[model samples]
Target chain A: MKPSDKAPSEKALVPFVSVDHMMQLIHHIGVEEMMSGIAGYIEDDFHRWELFDKTPRVASHSEVGVIELMPTSDGEMYGFKYVNGHPKNTKEGLQTVTAFGLLANVETGYPMLLSEMTMLTALRTAATSAMVAKHLAPKGADTMAMIGNGAQSEFQTLAMKAICGLKSVRLYDIDLAATEKCAANLAAQDIKVVICKTPEEAIEGAQILTTCTADKQNATILSDNMVGSGVHINAIGGDCPGKTELAAGILQRSDIFVEYPPQTRIEGEIQQLPEDYPVTELWQVITGTAAGRTSERQITLFDSVGFAIEDFSALRYVRDQLEATGLYHALDLLADPDDPRDLFGMLQRAAPGNA
Target chain B: MKPSDKAPSEKALVPFVSVDHMMQLIHHIGVEEMMSGIAGYIEDDFHRWELFDKTPRVASHSEVGVIELMPTSDGEMYGFKYVNGHPKNTKEGLQTVTAFGLLANVETGYPMLLSEMTMLTALRTAATSAMVAKHLAPKGADTMAMIGNGAQSEFQTLAMKAICGLKSVRLYDIDLAATEKCAANLAAQDIKVVICKTPEEAIEGAQILTTCTADKQNATILSDNMVGSGVHINAIGGDCPGKTELAAGILQRSDIFVEYPPQTRIEGEIQQLPEDYPVTELWQVITGTAAGRTSERQITLFDSVGFAIEDFSALRYVRDQLEATGLYHALDLLADPDDPRDLFGMLQRAAPGNA
Candidate 1:
């Protein structure tokens, strides 16, 4: 065959892990084990967080929803995730959030991986919470109170189980059907599951409280009275301005740890608190610069606002898995010409058959 | 098949236009005709420029190159382009720039289209220049002096011919091979092609002067003495900061026009000019609020640094063509659970056989 007719070179093909592949990979590694693996990567990245390029995500808000681009680089590698959140989408049988991401080599500015990030985002968010909880969760914490059990509910539960060695989870949601779905999905797992009718009942004897709901408004998923000292709280649902989960009373009572203060203050649970409220950076805790769980009776809240570096870590992990599993498709997403300057020549030579 | 075993739902699949498909689409419509079609879309969008949500692109700069995310939105649809530039990539047999983009519905915040944009960007950049020249070029202008015949050289020439009714092109490049490649690419076209040894030779009797060199520094491709009156200049190569093709003397002599003043002041040829240097916004001219070419002897310059709205227009045009031409593949890039909240249940159902 002539050079013109040859298949595209590897550089022109970005390794794309589709939804199906991501699912298969998760199953291949076991969901809990995969979450543990992802948490490990997040921990590695968080330890070296100073090396990352961080910026507040670029968001475009419309009447019903918001779309955002979260980008970051570590001198050698770069990544970005395109995600959208529309709380009303579920009513139309669509996901409330869907996402995709790209990872590229910073040296050549060429993409190395293109992967579906809806599933991956769910994984990474859960992993980040669990990884943070490892440092802050009370010693031998075995029970978790999972409120607002929606799409993210179960992942958060299993990630806690995998990374923190939790043996039981008590789930609660305002919607009974959502609670039932979470309970049924976990029935096959080794961990014990409890379905609680009220948020108060879910927190009974639980040391870890994970609240993940889907609402665009600031709804009180957990009030101050329900949270107690010596327990760790993972607040992930409050991830945008004007949308928060924990009551201001709970925030006042707890020592909050955050991903990036600039972002968390705007999007996380602390959006309810004063802008100048002091919160410790999670990376500092991981890097041994700040204290984590200094006292058993001290309430600790991981005010989680998903950051770009966690997604970058997830992309890096997925890219490393591609070669071993062969669970990816080579997407012809870039134009490659033999003579890089002659793009027009390449187009001319590849004129359509009908033309 | 079980519901879980069935193919992904429509909402889970995003339409992806690969490079091969883009080339096929371009060939089917003819390059000149395709660019004119794009120019038509651009004109329509430019007429309503005030409605767009615009922001300066977010760029990640490394030692060797830069990657950027350019995003914009109309009230109904939003779009963004991810592009990277690495000038040294040519030595590694890669294009200096490559890109891909997405368009989404503002109402749902779900992506509607994903397309390879290296080819599309080239087309849009050329079409934008020709579209601006059509409004600002001297009336009945026929010959264009094409300096720095690189990747974008052929498209610029043909777009001028197709949109502005140019009859001939005079090509010149510092590198002889580039000029030869451009000349050979145009040999199949109907327009007259002339190869010149130097920038001065290329401008002989040409009414339009187009400069598009790929360099990261300020270089005087066109001196003040080389440019005469009654001519239009399309200065596109001077895009990033510290990159300029025309000397300040030439800019001072011409009536500079730009896409967006805020960005153009930083990235366009006008970057060399004072911060408050007066320049006409090109969209205003299209909107009839600002004057374009009025006097024959008046020197006109289009300091073209690409804007996000142009990429949005290109994405819209490509998306509109997808249905009619059936030129895209539906990529399973989103996870859609039967119950939106049952993502974990979906994962359980799709557990790997090896497990």
Candidate 2:
């Protein structure tokens, strides 16, 4: 028998969104609008959280970082993300985090969407943060203090503007160049961008404080003295075990809300506290089952550890918009033989020179 | 900001082998040779199984099927397979199992290979069976009794012929058409094929009995009365809970061998036995740390549920062969930026009209 390369069947082609295509889709919809769009999907899924298969993300941790598989289903559709986080990668001219995701049919288990999620993850993470802020921030909040301006700083600031109607963003990072890069990126956007020299100065007079430093340590990007009452804090940096950005004193003082308590307990700011530390589920707040910001003097904290359902929602949103935007390629990713049982026959018929 | 779909950088492209390409590659090497090749890799990895990170596959079970993520790493490289098993799918003109896999560098956590594993999985499963049979089968075993002639029947037989020097095969299935299909696929091969009407007839003079029926429930494909002494049983179909092939009495008499005892106990034929049932790990036997077939009357049953390390070995083999074959597409699956920290800049630079 000879060998031949055969073309994939129609059923084998999965709609794939590359990073460039994702950027095009985002720009076509506008980054801020896309962020708001993803937030809407997140909010919708959170409203019906009981229907989802809410298993924890499966992880493979090594000495340097962790690679995780986040999967979820809503009876009809299923989705999973393959994401890796290696903080040391940035020093080696690689992104600290890179991701790709897939959406499939629960009934058939055939993949419908294959997407590059490195950019989309940044988008969804920011969108989730701002969406939580909209629920927990004080009324008439307009300013946000963004500490540790990095890859996510600009997107987080824009998402807050788009979803929570934030007017001004103050950026602060120990690396001055990172702050400058973020400020330059947002210079042409609608909101005000202020490059602050210190985290203390960045939080002054701000109604919302977002901490997004990228270190795998327990460094305090925002200390107890830096936070004030009547403010919503979005902590996006401390997402893995042994990694936290805010001081422990601040957690003790604030009302903490988290996405899926089981995961957040292991990989969020609350990991510093006792296992039984009281925290509110953000889904309950979205569904009005739990209280949000109640008093002007109280500080509310959204411990934003990423979740599988959020990736599921993001994949769902991509699949829904892909056809309309025409921003994806058909990926030959699965096998579909005419006679499924005769898989061997299909291979034999694909012999070289037969075609 | 404008949007443009930029071509992925060389670093960002992952080599993708579709099912069609997988078949072509297999044909290029010859199916029997490919089977033996995969078996060799599986055997090598089995010998050093202690170096691998062994964990139970993460599964999401639906009413009709399951979607699973099987991940394993050898400190240097990481691999995982996304596979689904739906027993009723063949009735709907879909394969009962479909899969795709990814291999990545552990140092950088970046994907290096993305291949369609639907056909590769079939090849690897068969190779694994043959490799285990080489260690546990009766002395001078030349014939195999295959009870389920489904998609895996021909592959299994060919693999046995290539690796274990099998000279003849006896095939039996509840569906006559499946048996005919298996027989027809092996008609031109080097081995003699016999289509049997019943399980008892199939195992008449065979020294190895392999049961691979596709039933979801524990319907005994092989009972204690039919089995003879000194024969090895390769049980492949009983891969999930509530799914078993051999009778509990057969399990009681045979010396069970398994890949990853914790996983096999939950998803293999041993699920019918007590949790503390004595079983030897196949790796220990391959490494000469444990005993194999001891006497002419001893029955060795390999309870293979398939492990991540096997898939890892398969992925590694494909990656090594990819460059020589040129049987892959460069999938733009990862986002690579000129400045890793400036992912936003990459997206912004991709704005169509701006460029």
Candidate 3:
């Protein structure tokens, strides 16, 4: 065959992991193993967080929801995720969150991987929570009180079990159907599950509490009186301005740990508190620059607003694993001319069959 | 088939236009006709520019080049282009710029169209230049001196011919092979083509002068003595910082027009000019809020660094044409579960083949 009829040149193709491939990849490594692996990558990035470019995510807010582009680079590789959060979408049979990401070579400015990140985002968020829990959760913490059991419930449970050796989870949500779905999905896993009706009953004996709800308003999912001392709280639902979950009293009681102070101050649970509220950076704890969980009586809360570096690390991990698993399709995404300056000639040659 | 084994739901798919399909679509519509059509869309957008969400492109600069995300919305639809610029890439047989864009439903936050935009960017950039020229060029202008016969040279010439009724083009480049390739590509066009060795010889007797060199430095392709009165100059090559084509004397004498002043001040040819340098917004001219080409002896320079709104307009045009042409493939880019909050269940069901 002539060169024109041959498959696209290597430089013209970007490796794309579709939703199917992403699912296949998750299963290939096993869900628990994948969660553990992703946590390891997040930990490595956290140790070297100072090397990354850290800017607040660029967001465009609409009346109903918000769309954002989170970008970060490590000097060698660049990555970005295009994501949206519309909490009302689930009522219309659409996801409240959807995402896709790209990883490019910084030297050449050419994309190396493009992947469906809806599923990956769930996995990475869970991994990050579990990794942070490992560093801050109370000693011998095995049972997690997973309030607001929605799409992220099972993944969070599995990641906690895989990374922090959690043995059981108590789930509660305003909608019992969501809790039922979470329970049914985790039936085959190696952890015990408890379905509870009230938020107070869910955290009865658990030492770790993870709250991730889908409400766009500032309704209190966790009340101040419900949270006790010596338990680590992983708060993931309060991720945008004017959409927080924990009560202001709870934030005042707990020693908060955040990804980035600037972002957390605006979008995390601390948005309700003063702008200059003191919070410790998670990377500082990981890198041994700050103390973490100094005593069993101390109340520690990880205000988990996702960051760009976490996405960058997730993309980096996927890029490293893509070639080994072969669970990707090469997309003809770039236009490459024989002579880099002859794009017009390339179009001229493609004119024959079009007529 | 069982419901679990069925194909993905329609909401899970995004229409993707690959490089080959983009080429076919361009050929299906004649090149000049497509250029004119894009110019029409751009003109329409320029007239309604106040309705757009305008923001400076978010760029991550590396030592070698830069990667940028340009995003905009018209309240109903949102679009963004992922583009990279590495001038040193040409030596390695890669195009200096490669781009891809997605048009999304603003209400749903779901992508409706994903398209390869390397070729589309070329077409849109040329169409923008021509559209600007139609508003600012000398009356009855028929000839254009096309400096730097790179990937963008022929497209610019043809766009000028298609949109402004140009009759001929004079092409010159530091590399003769680029000029030869551009000349050969435009051989079948309706416009007269002239090849020249020197920039001075090429601009002779031309009413419109276009300069789009590829160097990263401020090398003056047109000296002070070269540019004359009443000629419309389309300056595109000097897009990034520290890159310029015309001498400062040329910019000092011309009535400069720019897409967005905030961006043009940092990345366009005006980067060399003072921070408070006066330049007209092109949209203002189109909207008749500002005057364009007031005097016959006045030299008008279009400082074209490109803008996110132009890409938004281009994506809107492609989205409008997508269904009619039927040249796109549906990509499984998003995860859509029957129950929006049952993502864990979806992963558990895809486990059969992974083992």
True contacts kept of each: 0.88, 0.66, 0.78
**Lowest summed lDDT window (length 10), candidate 3 chain B:** B1-10
What is candidate 2's CAPRI-style docking category based on DockQ? medium
State the lDDT at B210 in candidate 3: 95
- Show pairs that collide, candidate 1: none
lDDT of 3 by residue, A207-268 (tens): 99999998888979889999899999999999999888899999998899999999999899
| Model 2 C-alpha lDDT per residue in residues B1-355, reported as the tens digit of each score | 2233266778788899987788889989999998889999999999889989889998888989998899999988889999999999988888889899999888888999989999999999999999999999988999999999988989999999999999999999999999999899899997999999999999989998999988899889998899878899999999999999999999999999999998999999999998999999999999999999999899999898999999999998888899899999988788888777677888888787766
TM-score of each prediction: 0.98, 0.98, 0.98
Error of 3 at B107 (Å): 0.5
Interface RMSD of 3: 0.7
Model 1 ranges off by over 4 Å: A353-355, B353-355
lDDT of 3 by residue, B129-216 (tens): 9999999999999999999999999999999999999999999999999899889888888789999989999999999999999888
Question: Residue A260 in model 1: shift from native, Å?
Answer: 0.9
CAPRI docking class of candidate 1: high
Badly placed stretches (over 4 Å) of model 2 are A1-7, B1-5
TM-score of candidate 3 to 2 decimals: 0.98
Please name the candidate that would achieve the greatest DockQ relative to the true structure: 1
